[model samples]
Target: MDLLGNGPHVRQARRDAYREEDSLRTRRDRFKGFTNITTGSKGEGLTCCFKSDSDVMRVIDNVMCVEDGVNCNNISREITFMILNFRYYYHGHCKLRLGRRDQFIHPFVRRALWNDEYLSKE
Candidate 1:
């Protein structure tokens, strides 16, 4: 008999519990105008064994990232655009700079700007 209860059924039960918890957390974040994207071991439903830390990425809904050469003439005025500058970094990583001078700057991003330039992934 399995005294420790470390069988396949037990493992699957743990994963299902963790997944339900994550779904609730994600729903809460959505109400706050942010999307929670889970990653790492805990996100993959591997919480049956060793302890794992939760890694979540909260993406803001009002902020938008666009390419350096993309035309923003048709974009909504309420959305804040962060122009991606690829010249300073390699692929898959880039620095987020402010868009056109006429563009409206969100208060949150405006407070973090350094000389009208946003933060980078350096």
Candidate 2:
């Protein structure tokens, strides 16, 4: 069954509707200082039903992540930096190491630190 109707026009209309909804969500998140990056079927405007779930990744601009050997001269001092350690590999994710101990780290991230070095994937 064609949930978005049979014609090309109908499919385009459905996609436009989804895009509008996603745009509104992005604007709302931006007001709270977070950038919402949508992923999955809903993000791609392939959602044919309201029951479909939207995968969203929220990024805070105040936090930055960079790999080792990357230049940090252009980064703002006010932002928190977390080093991405590709050396310590997990199943599908790279390890995140605390860049500087002197800077302020969020309580949640602080609690997740392993051995006062890398952040736990848990």
Candidate 3:
């Protein structure tokens, strides 16, 4: 099975593997950059009114930046989960859960991160 260099399929497979690896590497780098900015190590100028490393700050930005036709309310659920995960990691429990989806998402987002419930079972 000297397929490594002997067949077009093998060559295509190798190309596909290389492309996948490259894509993953690019995504990893992009995430690393985001992590740096969100943690306040970079892009500090992008945010105001909240601590740079606050996950709530990132969630607010992301909610505000969504494209038209995409419902920010719907996406807020996911963002709530992200914030909750961050809280659970840094602290021991999530003390926040988002309000009713029918209400605008930004108000809840604007509330202090530590003082709200964005992912409560209710």
Candidate 4:
């Protein structure tokens, strides 16, 4: 009883589907709290941006890569992880309200989030 039937194209498509599913899962797990993701040009190359939603006590680790987008460099490496300490200065503490999921983050807002000192404490 071949539930998936039998065809070269069918098998290839199924494999591709599985691969895509796995890739999406990897991104989701790697960037659990991230939301309102979008892609656009940054300087000269394309970039992906999203707001994380982890609580003040959560630890930030791991570099995240998104589908059809560039790798996140600023938050990709090791840092002291001071989001909790500076949570009060930001609006939602940990829950970044990024508006529509399709809308790219504003340049000013992105710059604010990507602030060097803030991103890499200690």
For each candidate, give its TM-score against the true structure. Answer: 0.62, 0.63, 0.23, 0.24
The candidate scoring highest on TM-score is: 2
lDDT tens digits by residue: candidate 2, 1-122: 26545456655676677667657877877756666666676555555646577676777657888988888767666667888877757666787766665566655556656455244432
Model 1 residue 57 CA deviation in Å: 1.0
Best by lDDT: 1
Off by over 4 Å in 3: 1-5, 31-122
RMSD for each of the candidates = 5.8, 4.8, 17.2, 16.8
13-93: candidate 4 lDDT, tens digit per residue: 544544455456556766463232212222111221222321212222331223222333454233211222224456644
Which scores better on lDDT, 1 or 2? 1
TM-score, predicted candidate 1 vs. hidden true structure: 0.62
Q: Sort the predicted structures by TM-score, highest score first.
A: 2, 1, 4, 3
Candidate 4 vs. true structure, TM-score: 0.24
Q: Give the whole-model CA lDDT for all candidates, comma-separated.
A: 0.70, 0.66, 0.39, 0.36
Task: For model 2, name the residue pairs that clash.
Answer: none
For candidate 3, the per-residue lDDT at 73 reads 49
Which structure is stronger by TM-score: 1 or 3? 1
Whole-model alpha-carbon lDDT for candidate 1: 0.70
Q: State how far residue 107 of model 3 sits from its true place (Å).
A: 36
Off by over 4 Å in 1: 1-23, 29-31, 48-50, 88-93, 114-122
Give the per-residue Cα lDDT of candidate 1 at 52: 61
Measured on C-alpha atoms, candidate 2 has an lDDT of 0.66
